[model samples]
Target: SRGRGFGRGRDRFFSSDYYPYPHRPGYPWAPTLSREDEVRMLKSEADALKRSQKEIERRLGELEKEE
Candidate 1:
């Protein structure tokens, strides 16, 4: 029981060379966020979706005109 201890083992497990898969989560630990940050993030995503939707509609209309 007197080896280098748990932290050393855990560190070796997470070291860069040990990554075996492409889909590893970007962060090593769970993130922390408050209600305000969560709301802001959701609003931004909604705005992006709406803008992309309108752009897609415009592109579809243009394609229809070409035919």
Candidate 2:
């Protein structure tokens, strides 16, 4: 029968367009930044986090006062 052919079930595993692995040829690696650039990025992230934390604390205090 057609379903019993040797090539019938092979396309799912060995198809040309199938990507069974994570190694992509067109994908790029992360860029390497200088020490100063890395420090700047971290500092900006820390500042943002600190601002968010302060906002969250203010909201929590308001909720506690209402309770």
Q: List the residue pairs that clash in candidate 2.
A: none
Model 1 lDDT per residue over 1-67, tens place: 4433356654434463456678656857868889999999999999999999999999999999999
Candidate 2 ranges beyond 4 A from true positions: 1-27
TM-score of each: 0.58, 0.59
Candidate 1 clashing pairs, residues 3+ apart or interchain: none
Q: Would you list the C-alpha lDDT of every candidate in the order shown?
A: 0.78, 0.78
Model 1 residue 32 lDDT score: 83
Cα shift from native, residue 1, model 2 (Å):
24
Write down the lDDT that model 1 would get: 0.78
Residues 8-67 of candidate 2 have per-residue lDDT tens digits of 554534444546568546757989999999999999999999999999999999999999
